[model samples]
Structure formats: structure tokens, C-alpha cells
Target: MIKVGITGQAGFMGNHLFNYLGTKSNDIELISYERDFFKNEKTLEAFVSSCDVIVHIAAMNRHEDPQVIYNTNVGLVNQLIDACEKTSSSPKIIFSSSTQEDQDNLYGKSKRDGRKALEKWAIESNGEVVSFIIPNVFGPFGKPFYNSVIATFCHQVVSGEEPNIHSDGTVNLIYVNELSAAFYSEIISNKNKSTIKMIPFTSTKKVSEILNLITSFKVDYIENGVVPNVSRDSFELNLFNTFTSFIPKKHFPKKYIKHEDDRGAFVEIMRALTSGQSSYSTTVPGITRGNHYHTRKIERFAVISGKASIKWRKINTDEVFEFILDGKEPAYVDMPIWFTHNITNIGDEELITLFWINEPYDQEDSDTYFEEV
Candidate 1:
């Protein structure tokens, strides 16, 4: 279990990293700093002091002015280093830097400066800061343009537009999930300290080849400086793209069955709501069909397609409620927390329910209940 604190909680890359770390693979306690890394100095200090790892993914990587880059990227790293030094314990600081060989852009220079600061900090502390330099990570969550070549292509293709390639630059791009897995491998798996891990997309294929294979888009490969020579043979990426294409749409509001309530408990517990006797038939969906209850435990009626209302009530409340079991809009309906109820399908076909409850179900933690309503 690692106590990891993330600086840019809402930033695209940082968000992906946070989600990856939050998975079941490792026991991670995460606290998101919703403010800028430097602005929230006190919060960052407290977070770094308490945690074992401080992953600095908050930096201005793209800026027109060199001075702005230096101030934001390099200066931010320096502040973080100072905070680390002042902390009670020396937390391992891992910095995420970029890679661009040909251009001496503001982003590239700032990253270089940040790396130097990290090195200086490590030396000052006698090799205490464990750092990792990552290059060109592309994934599902990130927006296409910012530091991601593959995403740019994918974004263009998905939006019914053609991809724009600058000088056919062939840079190594690792999938976000793959990069995340690699980080876990380097950090938690590798116990050796006083290490600076640099995972460059050094051996990846040309951007031109990836475009040709994945889409029917036209690409003009630009012969650039020191770009990798490897041709794109991304079987994994292609296969995923193919599968995604066939789906034609994304699934929203993912569905799952609610089984938190036991059949026996629900049946017995629901008996208390019976202020008045109600007739219910078996052969319907069963006791487990309408197992979920709203947050306030409001009364509800399970309408049997052809049968009568099965009157039921909540235990302690003893609130009176009824159900319209037969028609599309069952009459005598007093559904809320008061009436815990279930209906049967007396007519042929699936029981078409025109169900209603007095109150909307409290979406969080209210659905799974054993009590009647």
C-alpha cells in the first residue's frame, strides 16, 4: 500500500494517473490538491510530509515565452524541492518531463530545467529524491493535441476530419495504461533507492506508419531530427481501434444488478408495513425483483400485471401505503417509504410496469435495502 499525493488532481494526465493508482491493483490512499501546486503551498507541504510519494504532474509544459516556461515549470519544481527539504521526512518525488529532440521549444527547455533542478535536489539530499522522466504517453482520457501525437490523429479521425502531421515526426508513444503499469513496476516493485528512472519512447515506430495502418487518412511524413526509425507495427492499437469502430457508440450509465438485499430478509422485514391486508400473487418477477428502495425508505408498490396490489409497510415507521397492482397506472397508489411492496405478472409477456414512488431514490447507498419501502 502506497500513500501517494497528486498535485494536479484535475489536470488531464494527473487525473488519468490518479484513476490508475486508485485501482484495486495497489492499496493507495489518494488526496487530491484542487489548487495550483505552488498556490497551495501549505496543503502541498502537509501532503508531501505525510505521504511516501509526491508525484508532480502539475507544470506549465506549453508556453510561448521562455521566461514564462522558466517561471512556471522550472520555478515550480524549485518550490516543490524546497517544500520537500522542509518536510519532516524526505518523500520520494517523481517528476514527469517531456521529450522533444529537434525543437528547442519553451516546453522542452522548461522540462530540461526541471530535470536539472531535480538532479540538484537529489545531490543536495545525498540521493534522496527518486525521480522518473517519462516521454510521450497517449491514452483514452487525454485530449488529442497537448503533448500527444496519436491522440491528435484519433481525435481528427473520430471527428470526421483528417489528421495533421508536422514533419512526419516519429516519436515513441506509449499507451496511458501501459505507462501507468510501468510506473508501478518502477516504483513499488523496484525497492532500490537513489535511482532516477528515465522511460523514453526511444524505440517506438514512426508516426506516419501508425496513421496509415489505423486510418485511411493521408499523411506527409516529415524527415525530422533524431526521430526514431522504427516503423509503427502496433497490433494492439489497431485491434483496439477495430473493436471500437464496430461498437459505433459508447455505453453510458453502465448497468448492474442490485443484490444487496436478501430474499428472506426483505420478505420478513417488509411484513411490518401491513397496516391493511393486501393480496399478492406468486409467479411474478419474485420477491427479489423490486429489492431496491429509495434513500428515505419511502413506500412503493410493485404492480402485478393482472393481479391486485400487495400492500406492505416499513418496520419502525408503520406508515400506511398502498399499491395499484393491476392496470398500467395502478390506482390506490400510495407508494413511498411507507409501503414496501412487490407485484406479479398475471398477464402474458414481461410485466410492463408503470411504477411510481412517493420520493426519488437517493442514488447513493439508498437502493439496496431490506425494509419494505
Candidate 2:
């Protein structure tokens, strides 16, 4: 197994990459890293020496003073190099540079210089360094303003704030999960070269176009409780998932409109603009089901009969969210990607739940990972 460590394991991209690597425990052993290690030479050296590969992702992205951003980013690369040299370690370093390297900004200059410094270190120390010139990245849990336009727009729309576009220029974007997969592939490749690779963008969109898409998501999914028309693995689906991640926990357990007549009462379980597979399950009293999560699937659980308690917890997070639903008042809770969840029958009698997923389950590639909520 390759012993790998990420320098910025707690930051947005770092967290995504770290969690993605966690899912490959059989082939890789993750080395823990903290931001504080940069402040201590001994600790940093120890971290560098213990790893077979180090993913250098920690870097300053924004600051009031552009020079501070530049200095901090370059300083971080130098520090990592110092730690490697001090410990006589020659671990392969995978540096997360950016497409900004070609732009006329201090941030871009910092990335260029950092990559150059790492390349120099690799040549001198007989080490390996693969620098990725990455495009704009977007995904769940990104900082509203600091991360990217998608993150800022998602947060603004979800928080009832209008998103204003300063520039409608086209942008090349890559989803965080996709970027993480690329990083994982690089780690597995274990190439012995100090070269740079331009990571291809998965989607391209104008700033205004993205805003329109996410705004429609708010209107359809958030307000009307209708899933947007998006196919599996489409950019729209990824953006929709990212938009949903910003929704407040209280927004869930949305009550379904009940239509009552002389014979009986009926409630619509789901309304989707796209095709999906629907299934139902009956659970005995006090029994729990679904200690699993999906990475790309859109799923919903509706309590059609009996009382049920649905719980959710984002992977690698400590906080948990829960909702209670009853048959009398039919309601549902949608599952966001990367959050482990479970449903428990809380009532005395058997509980029935209607499940809807964006796609039919394929055993060969289920995209389901089991984890406790």
C-alpha cells in the first residue's frame, strides 16, 4: 500500500481529496496532516519523512493584500521543500497548481514559482514532482465567497440572497470528486518524472449561465420540492447536488400534499423532471435500514406508512441531522451525495418507505458505499 499524505487535509479541496482517498483504504494508507505542522520544523519533517507520496494542496487563495497571498503560497512550497531536505526524504510530491498560472496576477505567479521550486527540489534531491495545472473547481462544502463562483452562487441562492454577476465570462470547471479521482490515479501511477500536466476541465459555462441553472434549481428543488431535469453524470446533476448541499437541514422532511376523498387519502411521493427507479421497503418496528451513501445518485425516502426517523451525517463530519416523519402526514427527505444516512422504524407497527433514485441500480457499478450515519 502507498503511504500518502495531503498537506491541506482540512481545507475545501483538501477535505474532498482526503475523503476520496479514504474510500481506497485497501490500496493506500493515509498519513494525517494538520495546518499547524507548517509552523513546526520537526513535525513537518516527520510528516514528510513518513510519507511515500505527499500531495501539496495547502496554499493561500485570497487575502486583502495580494502580496500576502503570493508570499504565503510560495512560502508554503519552500517550507515543504525544507522539510524534505531536512529529513533526507525523497517522497514524490503532487502539487496542485492552477490554470491561474498563466494569468497576470500574484496568485498565478505564486503558483508558477511554487511549481518551479518543486521541480528544482525534485532534480536536486532525485525526487519526483507532478504538478497539475488545474481549472476552476466546484463542489459541495466549498466556501461561499472564497472558493469559486459556483460556491458563492449556491450559497447566495440558498440563503435567499440574489446573486449578481460581475463578469459573464466563460469558465472551465472541474468537479471536486473528478479532481480527486485524477489525483488518486496519479498516486497509483507512481511515475518518476518532474513534469507538469494540464488537468482538463469537465464543464464550461458562462457565469450568467451557471447562475441561471442554479437559480432554476432553487425554484424547482428547494421551493417546489421537484427534482430538476438532469441526467446522471451530467454537469447539471453535479451542480444540482452542490446546490442542495448548501440547503439548511430544516428544509428537509418536506411534507407531501395529501389529496383526500371519500374512499381514502393519497399523497404524491415524488415529482421529478427526469426518469428514475422507484422502490418500496417494509421494515419491522425498531428496525433500521440503509446505512449507506451514494456519490452520484439522487435518492429520496418517503414515509408512506408508520413513523420513521431518518438520520444523516456527512462523511468525515461529526454532526448528525435527523428528521421524523409519520404516515398520517406523508413527508420525504432527500439524500445528498457523500452523506451516510439511515432510516429507522420508530412506530410500533411495520413501517413502509417509498424510495426513488435517479437511476436503476447496477450491481457492476452501484456507486454505493456503506457507512454508519
- Each candidate structure's count of clashing pairs: 12, 0
Q: Write the per-residue lDDT of candidate 2 for residues 254-319, one digit (tens) a residue.
A: 999999999999888889999999999999999999998888899999998999999999998899
How well is each residue in 217-323 modelled by candidate 1, as lDDT tens digits? 21210111111112222434322332232211222111112234454211111222113223343454433344333222223243424444344453234554443
Error of 2 at 191 (Å): 2.6
Which segments of model 1 are wrong by more than 4 Å?
101-103, 189-192, 200-203, 216-235, 238-373
Model 2 whole-model lDDT (C-alpha atoms): 0.94
**Pairs in clash, predicted candidate 2:** none
lDDT of 1: 0.52
The 10 consecutive residues of candidate 1 with the worst lDDT sum are 220-229
